[model samples]
Target: MRHLSDADVEALLPPPAEALRLVHDALVALSRGEAEVPPKPTVHAPGGAFANAMPAAYPARNLLGCKWISIFPDNPSQGLPTVSGLMVVNDGRTGAPRAVMSAGALTAARTAAVSGACIAALAATGAPAGFTGAGLQARSHLRVLEALGHLDVTVYARRADARAQLMAWAEEHVPRVRLRVTDDAREAVLGRPVVVTGLSIGLTGAELDPSWIATDALVLPLDYASSVGPALARASVLAADHVPQFEAVRVAGTLGEYPATTTWTGSLLDQARPDGRIVCQNLGNGLSDLVVAAAVADAAEAQGAGHPVDTGSA
Candidate 1:
């Protein structure tokens, strides 16, 4: 079996544009009910950090994969990353483990690609757009927005400290994009026809002013797992990366009540929307991970990337 390190994963995966394209195509397939994805299950215990296992299958390619991700939100105290994970790729036919690869980079890439897809879809509608949160995911979305289209991205965070830190970093890295630190959610949401929220809203329970979202605007909440759905129920167009995943979480009783005109991400790709409010909530699906994992593995193999596996198992 091939093994890929984080560096290898970074080098092997497709470029941002290519990854976004793949994600767009994949969403189309998903909306057509051509792809298969499983719900991610989480287990938390006292004295232990939160961890999750996500598995997914691709029907078209006959592939199966899983990502084991853990979030030590307090890991910063140890000078470590807040999130870490790995992706295991397996053969659908024989169930043989084909590769063990880094999931962190893949996660970033896939997350950015999904954001790109949503931005492109929403941009097609011609409306004022804004981006909330200024973390790694928010930066990734900015990169995607730069590559695919143009949209005004605004940064909103609970702490002035975090916002200042992110703005300094942005000035050094992404100064071309319009970015401002907003204390008021209303200021962040007002007049923006499209908005992307990349923070862990589920964990923070941050609420947006209902009046800020114009009746004609569309809100895309990329982090849906921890999001309170009822707050966004009034949105006219509610699009999701995967309806089943949302339902699974709903069944698990994790998501509270939210009303929306339910539509899949695939639907956006298949047709065009003229107007009306559209909100796309991304809980993230395993199939998205699997597609990205396979692409990374293939690139690694073709380029002779990754660390040489030692016979430690032997």
Candidate 2:
């Protein structure tokens, strides 16, 4: 077996455009029943933290993998990463273990890649965008948005330091896009054609006013109902990457009073864009993890970039 560090995974990751293409393919396959992905099961931790076990098989692409990822929202205060995990890629033919790679970079990449696909398929290029949360997902999404030709973005972050840090990073990395930071949530989202929320899940009193969102905006909530709550989501054409997972989460009370009619995001890609507000809650999907992790494993093997481990017996 081979082991890849976070840095190695980051270096092996596909560019935003390529990443988006990969995720788009996976989503399409999933929609067409060409992949096997069980709903991810969650386990809880102290302090409102949780972890998920995501397993998926993409026989069309000859890929198989599972990711164990955890989100501890309070970690940042302790100078630790909020998200961390590992991915195990298996041989599609024999089910033999192939590689164990850091999941952080891959998770962020695939997530932003999914959002990129949504933006490309749903919204106009360079439309004004708003983002809530200035963390890892925000940075990753900024890269994707820039790749998709979105040049104007406004971000809302409660912490001045986070906003400043993100701004500085954007200036150096995504120089083409202009970023405006705001402390007010309404100011960030009002009338924006694209709005992405990445705030911590399980957060209360952080939901945006439904009136603040444009009637035709594309709202992508990566963080469940943390920032995009029930009332706001109820007013939109709600869609999710996996309707079963969304329904499960709703049953668990994460999404309260959500609209009964929900469509799969991939299905929307094939159909005419629905009129009115569109909220696509891309709850993380294992098929995406399988696709991306397989790519990373292939790259690692080709470049000889990871550390090989010898399992004595197997």
Q: For every model shown, what is its TM-score relative to the native structure?
A: 0.85, 0.97
Query: For candidate 1, what is the lDDT?
Result: 0.71
List model 2 lDDT by residue over 241-307, tens digit each. 8878878888887687776547888888767888999999889999988888888898999999999
Tens-digit per-residue lDDT, 140-212, candidate 1: 7666665664545676776788789878877776666566778666677777867777655345556566667
Candidate whose TM-score is highest: 2
The segments of candidate 2 whose C-alpha lies over 4 angstroms from its true place after superposition are none
- Against the reference, the lDDT scores of all candidates come to 0.71, 0.89
Question: Which residue segments of model 1 deviate by more than 4 Å?
Answer: 46-50, 71-82, 91-94, 125-128, 225-229, 310-314
